[model samples]
Target chain A: MADRPPVRDWATDFDHTDPTWVADPYPIWDELRQACPVAHSDRYGGAWLPTRHADVAAIAYDTDDFTSRSVVVTEYRPPNLAPRGIAPPITSDPPFHQGARRMLLPLMSPQVIAKWEPSTREYCQSLVHELAGREVVDAATEYAQHIPVRVIARMLGFPEDDADRFRGFVHHVLEDVTLPLELRLPGMQELFEYLRDQVKDHIDNPRDDLTTALLNADMGGEVADLSHVGGTIALLLLAGIDTTWSAIGASIWHLASHPEDRDRLVKEPDLLPTAVEEFLRAYAPVTMARLVKHDMDWHGCPMKEDDWILLSFPAANRDPEFFVDPDEVIIDRTDNRHAAFGLGIHRCAGSHLARMELRVALEVFLDAFPVFHLDDPAAVKWSAGQVRGPRTLPVHIG
Target chain B: MVKIAIDSERCEGHGRCYSLAPKLVEPDDLGNGRVIGDGTVPADQEDNARQAEGNCPERAVLLEET
Candidate 1:
């Protein structure tokens, strides 16, 4: 066999099996990004890394050249996912992809997202208020975790009571990386069944929510069928809930660590918008993967078909070439153009909704508890892989 | 002075501009484009408005010199 690319020992130890890497993989990320910006790994069975910011951004936007098929990490790839992998619409190349995006675009219009802002703000305030006067509280469990799931539940026309249930299901899918295939398959089935039933209910009643919208959405003069609805819901749940939770938690962690930035925002409340952008750039919560559609050269590397290319959003956000002093959390950093929400066709559909939730969450929390501080930084925990964020952020609010 | 205006017809309702520059742009109750602050175009916010235009995924926002 030809010489294999050097694999990091940590990749073998942690790869997809180890739970330790989920806790805090930044050190490993730094090492990989520095040592091999385009390194391949044996543990992942020939997965290519694009650690630099520009490379990741280029690959993410170049859906025509570097397709989104098989976007899931090797660790998270399910057998059934392959059939739908990189297919038309979401995973497909342009022309069709453009139309698909357009079809779904109306559902996430600013007005629709803005209507949910009140609910999002109320939820965030309640979570923060519940933890008030307490020395320690799990910020992730109480705050970050609630926003996206709750918003999604409302959008999907599911009862607010189902938020915890759906959150549990999503958590199982994301965290249970090491579970047997048999066990893992059931989780997907359970979530699919739940969503399927939810869609059926919408079809029967036909409310004015997102489920209803999707069910009625005409894709070339035909309503979205079960599979399309199911896939869209799954995509929204995964993208809307988990990614937002990670970003909210990560933002809190960054604010806690950088008291100066936090204090500055609190002092000048007008800077909250800029502060939001800075937080997104400073701690992007998602790492993306795309499959090379056909054999094409990328940066002197012969990226072949089906080659899994990873996009490091956080790394790209911090690239000095893109942002000056990218490491610093300058709340009012002008000329900030980070790919936190990504770019091009596959750019997040729910980004506007996500931003509304984030901005409102930050605004409410800062206004409500300007003097809050972390009870213990060490108590905060993190999870990695496709989604990265604090597991628990303990804080004291007076 | 330069100001940004969102084309409601071509907006596609993506909301990228609103997210990028919420201070100057907001959606109505139905999520249609609505300029914040009576379209005055605050002096300090010109840059944000321009950035929103440049970053708009749909190119729905238009900047006009006054």
Candidate 2:
């Protein structure tokens, strides 16, 4: 009989599913970057992890071959889900994706995002006012979670009363990939239905918000994929809340632990925007993925079709080649160009909005509960690796 | 007289140009950048305009002296 080739083991060596690795991924990523820049694992049907900044940038830039059909390293997708793509431009490839993004991009343009600042500040102030007298605040739920949801809620034309439920849906699809498929399936179903109804509602009613704007968007000679619009809203709900929430929560956590940085910000309020960029650099919140369409050797690692590759923006932000003293949070850090919000065509459409929220979030929290410290930094529980941040941030505010 | 023009294809609307040289760079509704007033970059603000051009990640912003 002819000799058979040994089966390749994908899950060997790298284990992102491990809690220890998830808790502190920097070390794991560093180890991988040094030993194997293009690390592979069998976790999600043979996934690839690119730890270096330059390699990550190259893959993101080359959407021609390495497409974005699956934007998550671990696929929590339900059976019979459309093979085309899920979240509009994020999961879509070019031409189609380009038209879709151009159609939706104007809605989040800098001026439009800037216009929301007053209202975002208003929302932050109200939350601060409510937490004024409290010496203890669950900064995660109380402060961080509220800011973006309110802004997103306003954008979606959803009622404030529905915030908790929608957030639950967001958490379900985006965060709870670890949950059993049966448990996660219902939430996914509900989320799909909700977005579809919203799109339908806008098509009929046409209100004055993102939904209406997306509906009225000219597709620039391309046929409008209503499902793509629905997927865009779905993407908005899933993406909108947690990413900014994590950044805000993690920023406060950093400041609380490092009093000097906290006080520096309080004294030099003008440096808030600069500091916000640094905050994003130090504690970037998202790590998105791309699906391998064709067999290609990337950074010498053979990536097969159907394999998933994670572009760890967080790890990229900390690459020594990219940033000076990448670990330390240097407020007012200049010449800083970190890709907290992914790079290339799929670069975060909500970058401006996320930045505005972070600036206001920290400013409001500092004003409301000054001189706060983590009651037990050890007790801080992070979200399951996908959308990274504190699930419960307990702080003592004075 | 100097002028500013954006390689609309290259510009991803990072908005750094707007933040740096707001007087010259105007952000469209999608946040993609555009040069205001016939893409003219006045001589005095030329440095500021250059700064914007330099800062663009995509190098979409351009300076032209005509």
Candidate 3:
């Protein structure tokens, strides 16, 4: 008998995709949370809006109740790309999801990640050293972008020379929306083809690398085939490159804007690890989605099946309920159980590897250049959608 | 006197600690190591532990006084 509240239309032209919103969606997210943490959206074809931390976390881990298969926006899938609608396994519920995750877990283990630290650290240091005497340099393009792609390329046993090309392909695949479907499809096709060829080579050679590992991995009863290898590669490339790139740029931006925090880090380098956790909590790069499997009551709101829910981890990390003084970046703040890497079954598989890269990179940067500052904070540009990061960070090093 | 402890639940078996301080840590069949032997803190070994901790990809190992 009660009139329904006005639905939040997220897919409209007037939606929160404006330049300012793209740069920072937290204020808009905060507003949405206050208005209706579980409001429906007409634009997303009547998907539920879960803006609060607790609501998002609950949905993310409740695999039985909220499944991943139905969460992906089938309508949003660009034409010419492979069908992402074949849910139930890649985006499936329980048992199936658990099996896939368990199979891929070994590839992301701490031992596998540790082997790449030296190279990751070296790559970061080399980038810094290259810009040592320069008065101004694009931190995002030069350092953040370079480190992760290279590390990923090496892990997959791709040649170092292919790093730049692969980076370009990934950037276009994920970022270039202006291009026609004709162009986009080819880009996706090229990437998939390249991966397929590499996977084939690795399968034939059986090298002791990630590509080979994925090729050879037994998904228990099901053997990982080319499509499986392709999917895994695509996941790693997108995750390894985009997430770390965003975090590094965001971390540097935060440090540059807050000189006092930088000074504290310089004074006490021991806080780098904790600082990394805090940074991740503050600036999580990934925004995940989940789908309600059955009609259920959440936070007193009735929700139907097949409703898409977006979990904004950044918003959750800054939730006052879980973090004390969540807005302020407390470098040494321990007890950080932030879900920057989403919790439970679908948690970021590369979290340890990401931590090692971030820690080593920050450590080497602080050690090598103690008194550097941003050349022009205003010039820092940010990428939009799914992943967020400074497009360019020009810094002046001493 | 001092000792080292590794929480297996937390450990991803990175083996970086053993690589850093072989004398103090040894790896099991799964490459996960336990701190079984005494770690002689020769004045400079503090730096080694610090590096080991810093280099540890997983925050699995804890060094404490016995």
Candidate 4:
């Protein structure tokens, strides 16, 4: 983790990587939403956080004002690689983003995701089987973490045994935000090198996986080159894993802590879908960033060119202006228009997959062990930085 | 009778409408919500269709009376 100064005031000197914010950001965001909806921070080279749903949604939809060239706020800003930024679609702007995203949308559609459900459920059951006899299970590491890693690994045609390596790469990109460029560059380099090797393997021996599909993907009659293929692969691997993992881990953490919710879920299995949406609404794991296109006044804040906008869907989901009792978790909340999967053009491509995984993972776990609680609430450590969730969750299954 | 419609321009494919009202809406090839049977909401499914319209984050799902 980057050793930086602690936040003195959330409105002016807010840092998402700050210890206070990472520990639990709901309180910080709630405070900011009431006091300052658009909080500015000098850190990360002049970053802005829009805590309200309207502001975040406006930024997400306004492609002319903000560029998606770099969604992650790091020390080194990516050079203008518009149309096909560092990672196409997610990092690409407007006209190009749609085409780049369209290539992968069908692959992660509800129907495609449904096909993976049976296997995903089987995988979850196997994981539960492995942790059955254990009295104390670190659900985050033992179960939740492994689920998405395995699923994405299979999709990318990468060796599933390299799950730990993927986690290391994900940590470097998402969590290690405060690290200096020189230090952070190597981990990112290693990830690309690994991806290159996998692409090479797929080229040598074509298979029916996403990697192969990308290599042979057609972009408006033109085939994607190695760099485009590799960048898309990088996006899929990084974006797909940690986000869903956090959702699953956070849901498990919620159940472990709240016996009533857990009991209700166990008794009314049909309520899992509704409960899953509520969990997503309350504990949205992903917070995307965008760079300002030019100098402009946004909601009274004078934002400059290249300024980072920390578009927080989680904060928006909890805004009192949008939701009733935003802080409280209502498992049966039906009228939920939460932006957990985000809104506007850049809605999460893998949302359906993430939802399916969360539902299946929870269903399998609850069925296996209906009675479970936190082993040590103090021991639950959340990941620092943009994607927040319990990294080390100790649950007492027995 | 009530009818449901999804404006493609506004539907970013959150699929909330389809998830909340499966009988009334379904996701297309790209996962954007599409109304079932010319979007004519059965009398029995009016409540669900309305629920979906209210729950859409984009407010893309429109409830029309025929």
Candidate 1 vs candidate 2, DockQ winner: 2
Clash counts for the predictions, in order: 2, 8, 3, 0
lDDT of 3 by residue, A1-398 (tens): 11223324533222222366666677666666666655565434445656677877777757677766633332243222222323213454566565565667777766667788877888888888898888777878988888888888888888878887787776765556434456667777788778778877887788878878777676767775567567777777766787788888888888877888888999988878778878988888777667666888877767777666666777787777667887788887645657777755566767767778888877877777777678886788888555678888987775
Candidate 3 CAPRI classification by DockQ: incorrect
Candidates in descending lDDT order: 4, 2, 1, 3
Quote fnat for model 3: 0.00
Tell me the deviation in Å of residue A105 in model 3.
Answer: 1.4
What is the Cα-based lDDT of residue A224 in candidate 3? 58
Which residue segments of model 3 deviate by more than 4 Å? A1-16, A44-46, A70-92, A176-184, A294-306, B1-66
lDDT of each: 0.70, 0.79, 0.68, 0.91
Q: Alpha-carbon error at A335 in model 3, in Å?
A: 2.0
Number of the candidate with higher DockQ, 3 or 4:
4
Ranking by DockQ: 4, 2, 1, 3
Interface DockQ of candidate 1: 0.21
Q: Which 10-residue span in candidate 4 chain B carries the lowest summed lDDT?
A: B34-43
Instruction: Determine the backbone clash count of candidate 1.
Output: 2
Q: Write the per-residue lDDT of candidate 1 for residues A1-398, one digit (tens) a residue.
A: 12223324743223523345555555665666676666565444346767667678677666567766555565444333432432224554555565566567778866566688877888888887887777656778888888889889888889989887787776776556445566678877888888888888887899988888887787767775577667777777767777888888887777767778778888998888777877887888877777666787777777776666666777777766666876777888665666787755666778788888888877877777676668888778777467778878886765
Please, what is the TM-score per model? 0.84, 0.89, 0.78, 0.98
lDDT score for residue A328 of model 3: 86
Q: In candidate 4 chain A, where is summed lDDT lowest over 10 consecutive residues? A: A216-225
By TM-score, the candidates rank as 4, 2, 1, 3
Interface RMSD of each: 4.6, 2.1, 7.1, 0.8
